[model samples]
Target: MKKTLLALLFGSSLVLAACGDNASDEASDANNPQDAAESAAGTEIEPEKIVNQKCSSCHGGDLSGGMGPALKNIGSQLSEDEILSVIQNGKGAMPKNIIEGDEAEAVAEWLAEKK
Candidate 1:
């Protein structure tokens, strides 16, 4: 069940990223300031640091699996949007509505490259 959930989440992220990317060209100018700023910051936010500061308590440093599941290959498992959703809404055993807006998005972008 755990692996299944992870797979589902991963697939969702990929689908979401692809969908979002397809629409990016049309929404470039429509992006809010926060989106623009996050885009300016570039992709990937250093998972090690973000994990230590915001997620280690539950997810652990190696992200091999803990209160949360093994996350080492999450980059390959999930897409940017799915990652963002997890950060924003969390998942079973994980709290929701914690990280918000850009922080969530930045972490997502970072995590997407983890694999």
Candidate 2:
């Protein structure tokens, strides 16, 4: 019983770790500059930064593929609008609205250029 409990705890930790996003925590803090910047329009959202921070875990650091499918050439398969839809609505293991509003648009635009 003890061993089973330990195994469950370890598995749970891995799952939680994979889903963790420190940037989201910072963005939620009202006092943080990131929150303010994100709220404003035409803020020059950095899509690459968002991808590295928000997507690298699942899509792989280089986006060659990992737990998620290879997105390096996603534009070859999906248009900018389609990509945005997936980001907004999610597909398969991917969750919806990982980043919302202008930030989501920026990332979708950037990824669409990947092809």
Candidate 3:
């Protein structure tokens, strides 16, 4: 009877240990911003960085316009969807697909907030 009790206690301990590990993993995942953003509902692409890397060449570092028209207050001129379309499809003098996928959406979202 003592041996049986010991075995049961050992099994219970192992189960609890496994559960604790899972909980710890979940907590760590929750703490990670990228993981949380990816796991949650919306995409979390960084638009300002994208602009600096890609659009800054044409739009200017300050987005006040260079080769391309000033993007400042572009939100007032175009809706979010329109901005996304332009980024994906491109406008005159702007190359098509200058940005794509989540990057395009991120840029559009960022530009939309410029108003």
What is every candidate's alpha-carbon RMSD to the true fold? 12.8, 3.6, 20.3
TM-score of each: 0.56, 0.73, 0.61
* Predicted model with the maximum TM-score: 2
TM-score of 3: 0.61
Q: Per-residue alpha-carbon lDDT of model 1 for 17-100, expressed as tens digits?
A: 322342554377356766667757776555456556666545667777765687777889899999888877768856664556
Candidate 3 C-alpha error for residue 106, in Å: 1.2
lDDT of each: 0.68, 0.83, 0.78
Residue-level lDDT tens digits of model 3 in 7-114: 999777644532234466568768897776674756667889878867776778999998689999999999999999988777886766767888788789889989
User: Which has the higher TM-score value, candidate number 1 or candidate number 2?
Assistant: 2
CA lDDT of 39 in candidate 1? 59
Q: Count backbone overlaps in model 3.
A: 0
Give the runs in model 3 whose Cα sits over 4 Å from its true position.
1-43
Candidate ranking (lDDT, best to worst): 2, 3, 1
User: Worst ten-residue run, lDDT, model 1?
Assistant: 17-26
RMSD of 3: 20.3
